[model samples]
Target: MGKDNVTVLCNCATDEMVKDEALMDIVTTRKVIEFMEELCEREGYPKEVLTDNGAQFKSKEMEKYLSERSIDHKRVLKGKWEEEAWKERKGKCDDEAWKERKGKCEEEAWKERKGNCEEEAWKKRKGKCEEEAWKKRKGKCEEEAWKERKGKCDDEAWKERKGKCEEEAWKERKGNCEEEAWKKRKGKCEEEAWKERKGKCDDEAWKERKGKCDDEALKERKGNCEEEAWKERKGKCDDEAWKERKGKCDEEAWKERKGKCDEEAWKERKGKCK
Candidate 1:
């Protein structure tokens, strides 16, 4: 069983198994390769592996996999190991073979492990030395190369910089324009407000003048009415006086006629009075 609690497959030759660590995650060919790589690094490569003709072990992928690592693959016949004794016999054969090769296998495993370690260390040192050399060369060459590159790209750089400057200048001009436009609009608004205030003042003055004119017209009309009433009363008084004078004259004429021949004097007085 694998750590994931699934059925695991193993090589009976070396008792090496591929395990799955994740739940419901089956072992795949790629995983098998990765497992084998780690196993070979630790235990060295196996000479051969034997398996039944299961799908995992019988595909072209498996063939290519074993071929790449130079591992021999042997497939057992189908239904050959149905008997329990044959299974036991196969296990015994594998154990005996392992015992026979155990000493030689240990020696080869040690040599291979030591050789791989030395090779890895040598490669690491070589890579470090090469990296240092490349860095030195890059530092030395970069100064002159960069200068050349900048020389070649100067026109383009200048154009790019000039474009940026122009854009900034245009933005500044546009900002100034917007600011000036805002100030103008504010000034216009203030002027309109002043005009509105002036209009209100004018309206108030007109109303005041209209009020004064109305007061004057009312006073003049009242004065004209009073004067016309006084004149009418005075004319009535004069008419009454004239009627009284005429009555008196008629009485005097009757007296003169009774007194005999004062008509001429009365006429002369009337003429002089009229």
Candidate 2:
């Protein structure tokens, strides 16, 4: 790919490269920011980012975006990118050669060192090593067996303890439940008894009050009827006595006037005869 279209990100510590071919379409400050964001989200944000002084990387917006996230942005000096690239290639080559030399040297040194001591030590220590190995194997087996037995004992003890605890807990819960039930039943029975006694008392009091009220009402009604009847009889008797006195007075006045007229006529007849 052309250098103009390709963008490369490298880890300074690992010398690992991440090349973005997507920048071939169009590279702008916005696109650069978006790629950085996506990269950071996928991997992680870098402490420092070194890029060549391209317009997209040098823009104020790009600087602001990097600064806001606390990422240090470094612009490569003129010709520094190419120089660094050359140095990196040369360093890699030198490192590979050095590693090859070092590996050969280490292998030769180890072979010489081992050749001097390994055979004699092996001959001398073979029996000792076997004895030590046997002891270690025996110890390991015994340890495993002891651990197994201890584990079984611990498990059985734990089960027994757990069962006892559960039984005690169950018995406590049952006792508590029974006590609560008994208290509730007793309270309910007492409440019902009180209610029944109260109801009977209330009924008896109501009946007595009702009977007294009925008697008072009947007496009041009877007294009122007797008073009205007495008043009616007294009024009728007064009216009959007044009417009889008026009739007798009128008859006596008429008889007195008739007797005076007859006496005057008899005096006139005696005068005529003379």
Candidate 3:
């Protein structure tokens, strides 16, 4: 690399940028640096870097980045292509033939840049003139508007009219919306209340029906239990009477075994008791 050629600082930079609303957008600065590093790895290092006087060029991050990569750069200046190119291209040099071609290229680029600068200046002046004319026309228009507005309404009257108009518009809109919403709500509430009343009546009627059925069932169960208990008691009474009859029969058998038959049998027989 010779110092004759210029390296676009965009080469040394990756595609990162500083995009701010109050300033210009330079969103690809970091990306440009990374691209530069890749160039150093793939191709050779460039001579030097030429950049604009943007804050990003002088930023600490950019400085550190360049310093770490050992890249040199300078701010672009006017009417100093040779010096700028020497500074921009640190040590990048091709063959002598290429150098000659680069000189021709540099000459053409300088002329073109000068032409562009002139054109840009002319355009800026024209734009400024148009802006001034527009500002003057706008000022006149604003003054006329103020005059017309003043003729139409004074401050106090304008305020009162505007407030009343706004109030009436707001009230009309609000009342319409509120009435619609209230009507919907009232209809829904009436429907819900009717449904609730019907549900309550149905629930009460069902409860009464269930209660009557349960009471009848309970009464039947109770009567069955009482009947069963009475049958058990009658069975026990019959068993007691059978027991008494058996005991009396056993006593008569015992008297016969003792040779003391009944009075009728004793009078009719002598040893029939045997």
Residues 180-245, model 3: lDDT tens digits: 899999989988998999899889989988898898888889888988898899889889988988
Off by over 4 Å in 1: 1-24, 81-274
Q: What C-alpha lDDT does candidate 2 achieve relative to the native structure? A: 0.75
Instruction: Kindly give the stretch of ten consecutive residues in candidate 1 with the minimal lDDT sum.
Output: 1-10
lDDT of every predicted structure (CA atoms):
0.73, 0.75, 0.71
* C-alpha RMSD between model 2 and the true structure: 30.2
lDDT head-to-head 1 vs 3, winner: 1
Error of 3 at 73 (Å): 2.0
Compare the candidates by lDDT and give the number of the best one: 2
Clashing residue pair totals per candidate (backbone < 3 A): 0, 0, 31
Off by over 4 Å in 3: 1-5, 10-26, 78-274
> Which candidate leads in TM-score?
2
The lDDT of model 1 is: 0.73
Which TM-score value belongs to model 2? 0.32
lDDT of 1 by residue, 184-253 (tens): 9999998999899989989998999999999989988988898888789878888898889989999998
